[model samples]
Target: MTSTSARVGGIRKEVDAQKLGPALLIASSLVLAIRTARWPATSDEGLANVEWQKEVEHSGHIAKAMLSHLISRYPSLFLLKDVPWYVPTDEDVPE
Candidate 1:
């Protein structure tokens, strides 16, 4: 009975150590990331101004121009949501 209780206490200590270790690591990392973070400027950061410029160039029809600019600036893998350029539909003129 004494040996069994000692083993159980040891196991509980190990489990608690494991759980608290990871929790502390994650908390410290989050604090470090928040304190020393330098996020790069994305295209959408100044979206309104960019769209306004595109609108002027495209005569208030900025959809295609904005998409082209975005694709050129960012990686093709990025998924932009609610942008007019990405809707899938058949082109009116058949190839």
Candidate 2:
């Protein structure tokens, strides 16, 4: 009984250790990303993105622009949502 309990405790500790590393890494990365976004560099593209983010924020169009950026980044995102070239008929899926 003692040996089994000890092994189980060790396994639990190992899993907990694994979780801690990933959580720490993700938190640190998010912090760095926010800092970089809040203070963009002098590069033209970086400055442009920063300005766009600012303008969207000020104009209250942030959601629309953010959505557009996401869609543009993945041109094929709406491919699956698009209607087929051929018109659908009752034969396609009988009611």
Q: What's the residue-level lDDT of 53 in candidate 2? A: 63
Where in model 1 is the C-alpha error above 4 Å? Answer: 1-15, 39-95
Clashes of 2: 0
Q: Where does candidate 1 clash, by residue pair?
A: none
Per residue, candidate 2 scores C-alpha lDDT tens digits across 1-95 of 11222112121111222233444444445544554576655657544576556654543343344435645675443332322244344455465
For TM-score, the strongest prediction is 2
User: Scored by Cα lDDT, where does model 2 land?
Assistant: 0.43
Among all windows of ten consecutive residues in candidate 1, which has the lowest summed lDDT?
Answer: 5-14
Tens digits of per-residue lDDT for model 1, 1-95: 11222112121111222233444444445544554367444567644765445434443233344434545675332343332223223442255
Clashes of each: 0, 0
lDDT of model 2 at position 64: 43
